[model samples]
Target: MRKRATAKEVADAAGVSKWTVIRAFTPGASITEESKRRVLEAAAVLNYTPNLLARSLATNLTHQVAVFVDDFANPQKLPFLETLTERLQAEGLVAVLININNHFDHVHALLNADQRQVDAVILFGTAFRNETLSDRQLGRGMPPMFVLARDSQIDGVPAVVCDAELALRDIVDHLYERGYRRPGFMTGAPALSTALRRRQHFIDFWKGKGVDEIAILSADRYSAEAGAGSVRHYLNDIDPAARVDVLMCENDILALGAMDEIRGNFGLRIPDDIAVVGFDNYELGGASCYGLTTYEQPRIEMVQAVIGMIKGRLEPETVTLPGKLVVRTST
Candidate 1:
């Protein structure tokens, strides 16, 4: 291994105190401009990389924020991350992405925070209302935590939430006002916050109309194929006498997939036999094949709002963003 240069060597080369070299690396540390320039010059000449851990102990700040996201595989999360990173960069803070599959992984960040590897932590996509996030281990922290999801307020962490119920209600009311009934739902899991809100919206709407039952299906993946497969399952399982008049997919992919399966396999006409509605009206939903009726929540606005919450230094609180529904040919 190559011999590593030390801070003492840089201090000798720059003709300054060892503490002077440390202050240059620490954010908001008081140091003369001339001294900082000398340290930078000495560091360049000696090819020295500052020991971030030691500096973190000196300042009690790592200046690096850890971001916990469900998984990058979900396309919807990518944009949110990109926007958040841009904002974090603008604030002169590093955003480190940590994939959250294990519940106890968040605790690791706290350990890192103490060591000055990561400062604050931001959690994305997954809600904290469930047991995994509500647990004391996951909630306690050395670094402040912020959740980016709908219906947040997980234990100790403040939430950057969305108005999912209002969004769903608006979409449902729009369809109902347009003289549509017998709406069905497609969702994969009951535990997810977004899925629960959408699924319950259909129930409350129909129950208010004196309807006894509403057709529903569970999806495995948030993809077009999953949507298509879910519709197939519903078709095979539902009673022929009380088929769904409309399908309200929890996401755009499902709405588009169900529409394709309905058109290609079952040979049913859309908006005639059944109208379809979906959320997150992504590019696929807007495609000519789907032209899906869906709710377009302030996607970019939501991203900005969460980033804003994260950017706020020490003054942490909950933030709620608005959403809107759009009518298309599918309805």
Candidate 2:
């Protein structure tokens, strides 16, 4: 087997001590400029890869950030992670993704640094609960955290989120202005803070427009099946006198599903019997069958803002952005 070149060998070639060669690999370590340059040049000539474990132990930093997400395949999360990965890479940092299978337990692991490998954390989830990550932890010796989709009022931690309340209010007003009354609502999981806020704002906005009786359905998840089920529940469960003229879903898939249910199950004409709107505006929501009217989240702005927060422009904390509504065939 070929002998790997060690720090000692690099140091000999550079005319520096092995300790000096080691220092080049350590970030924030006390080392002279000249010595650091010579050590790096020698290491390059020797084709040396620094010992990551050793450097991590010495500097007390892994130069790695952990991003927590529920479903990576979800369209909403993909853009954020891709943008963050690119930004972090430009800064010579590695991003480690932690799949949040179990919310409570997985969140605990991401926050605590028993291994000392993670420098910071980013999450797409709503809020970390008291049992998962407490206020004490937020105030203590915890590394920086960037939370997306929640407010920035968690102690001093930074958050990058879209203003759900404002977005929903805007959407509701747009629909109302378009002469859409008897608005029906298909809301998402109440546990999610953003979802709850959007639902409340949507209802309040409808009520403000003189919509006395509203059709509202609750769904278990944000999926096509849930969307279809919510519509069915609305058609079956509601009183015959109360009819829904406009359907507003909290997600694109749900909107698509509701559109399907409205056509197939109820034999109703879309936009003729009921107009529909959705959030996130997934491609499927804009299918030929269901050109869904929905809000396009400022994906670019949100991504850039989060990158800026990670880049240290906005003091690493939660930042909420706004969204715009687009009309479609469904409406």
Candidate 3:
């Protein structure tokens, strides 16, 4: 086996004291530029890289974050994962992903995070209960957490989310101005809190505007197949006489599915007979064929907010960013 090169050996080769060599490797340590240069050159020649684990023990900071996400199949989540990991890498923080699909899985992931000594945790969904992450449950030295795209408040857990109510208001305003009175919502599974929040906000916003009645249909999941089925049910079973003038979907994928069904199955013209709108302005929304009118979440801004909390630059509190309404041909 090859002998490992130590800081002492680097110091001897660089003609500097061991203290100077340690200072040269430490961030923000007071060391002369000449000494640092010599120390780095000797380290390179000796093939000696500082052991991050040993340094973490000394500084009490691993600079590693554990990210937990459930909806890996969701297209929108793919971009979110990419952007988050890239940003963490740019900031010199290591990111470890824990793909959990349920509450029990989240608890296990939390335990794994603690075992790995991660500096922070970022959760991507709202499925995990707040109490499961409390200090009493997690013990005294639990990592600070940031929940992304979750609207509900989890005690002591900060969240970075988009304004669901604001997005719904924007859609309603656009549809109303375009002479759409009988508006309906096509959303995800009944068990999903995100779907419930979006549906309730739309209903409340319209009700507050003195609109007495609004229709809502639930899909089995947030997928194209479920969206198409919901639209079929809404048109055939719920509003068989084609009473709805506009359909607002909870996600872009849902909207696309509804659009396909409307044109292919129902033979209804889009934005002519009935307009369609969606949220999460996924990249496919910009395609000429779809051109879906929707609200775009400020994902970059939300990520920055979460990073700020991790770095102690921002308070650990829920931050809701306003979504931008992208008007397209679909509406």
Clashing pairs in 2: 158-316, 158-317, 158-318, 159-317, 159-318, 159-319
Give candidate 3's error at residue 78 in angstroms.
1.7
Candidate 3 Cα misplacement greater than 4 A, ranges? 1-4, 102-104, 134-137, 189-196
Compose the digit string of candidate 1's lDDT tens values, residues 1-331.
9998999999999999998998887679899999999999999999998886676676666668887765444465665677778877877678887665565454454555445557677766543344544446643445676777555545556666667778777877887787876778898433353223668866786677776577768887666788899898888777766788888997777778889999899898898888999887576677777788887767566656655655563357766666778788888
How large an RMSD does model 2 have?
3.6
Question: On a 0 to 1 TM-score scale, where does candidate 2 land against the true structure?
Answer: 0.82
| Candidate 2: regions farther than 4 A off | 1-4, 17-41, 71-75, 103-107, 111-114, 135-139, 152-156, 192-196, 239-241
TM-score of each: 0.79, 0.82, 0.91
1 or 3: which has the higher TM-score? 3
lDDT ranking, high to low: 3, 2, 1
Q: How accurate is candidate 3 locally (lDDT)?
A: 0.82
Please give the lDDT score for candidate 2.
Answer: 0.73
Error at 255, model 1, angstroms:
2.2
lDDT of 1 at 132: 49
Local accuracy of candidate 2 as per-residue lDDT tens digits, 140-240 = 56667666655544455566667888888888888888788788788765443222366778888888878867767887766688888988988887674
- State which candidate has the highest lDDT: 3
